[model samples]
Target: MGLLSKSRKASGDVIYNNEVKPQLVAKDGNIHIVMINSFSKLVNQNFGVESKYTEQIGSVINDLQQDGYEIVDIKFDSLKGQGITGTAEGFHTLIMYK
Candidate 1:
């Protein structure tokens, strides 16, 4: 008879406890953070619910920079459908020490 053997292993999905929570760190001895979200969504939230969301997104970005949040980077996802060619799906941003 063959000898019996036992083995153990561990595996599971990693649950994110801090998802979407703003992280602030000391970079170069200054406060730093990064934000990621849909720009169009934000504008829609801040401005109106039924208006054209894309143009408002641009306005919101400009306004944010004007308020001095160190808009370091801006990127956009692809657009879809018609009457919304310049529309961006979302964006990622890196805010430097401020």
Candidate 2:
């Protein structure tokens, strides 16, 4: 065990990280898409000005930064229906990493 080993995340952290982070990789390189919506909810939905996943998104960003990913830019979009699912209460966050 070394300095890096000491920084290793606990199993809970791993599980949470996996849940918050999308399985898709960056369209080009280190960029990633983060979806914050009711479908990702642990129980219910968040319809306030702030998102329920805001804090979780921050954690994911921190973890990505620790992995040598520099956040280049972030863009957000209000996501709507995909196919015929109808409107959704979620946001699409595009994160570019260097």
Candidate 3:
């Protein structure tokens, strides 16, 4: 890879290590974790539940699966002003267990 591209990849790695990876870790009991991912766009005039879900959280979920983590359940919510996404509309909660 070019020097600039390598630097960009390194920075992205740092970001994933610092941010995205932590969101998938267990909050308690070392068994399961609950993660919230937000979407700002809609698909096919609907929540685009599974597709959007797979698009946003797919890779991380795949990694977890390789490490023996399995998805227990997934839930969705449509809110206008709540949680970390004050005005965000589409959101999904992923529940995973090892």
Note each model's CA RMSD in angstroms: 17.3, 9.1, 7.0
lDDT by residue (11-90, candidate 1, tens digit) is 00011113322343433445555453433332233434423333333444444455454545555443332234444344
lDDT of 2 by residue, 1-98 (tens): 45433333332246336664455354366555544333223333455534334544555667767766677877777654532345443556666665
TM-score between model 1 and native: 0.29
Q: After superposition, how far is residue 78 of candidate 3 from its true place, in Å?
A: 2.4
Q: What is the lDDT of candidate 2?
A: 0.51
Q: Model 1, 28: alpha-carbon shift in Å?
A: 9.5
Question: Which regions in candidate 2 have their CA more than 4 angstroms from the true location?
Answer: 1-51, 80-88
Identify the leading candidate in terms of TM-score.
3
Q: Any residue pairs clashing in model 1, and if so which?
A: none
Shift of residue 24 alpha carbon in model 3, Å: 5.1
Worst 10 residues of 3 by lDDT: 40-49
Per-residue lDDT tens digits for candidate 3, residues 17-92, read 5665676665444666666655543323454444433444554555556655666765566555544535545565
Supply every candidate's count of residue pairs whose N, Cα or C atoms clash at under 3 angstroms. Answer: 0, 0, 0
lDDT, model 3, position 83: 45
Candidate 1 yields a Cα-based lDDT of 0.35
Extract clashing residue pairs from model 3.
none
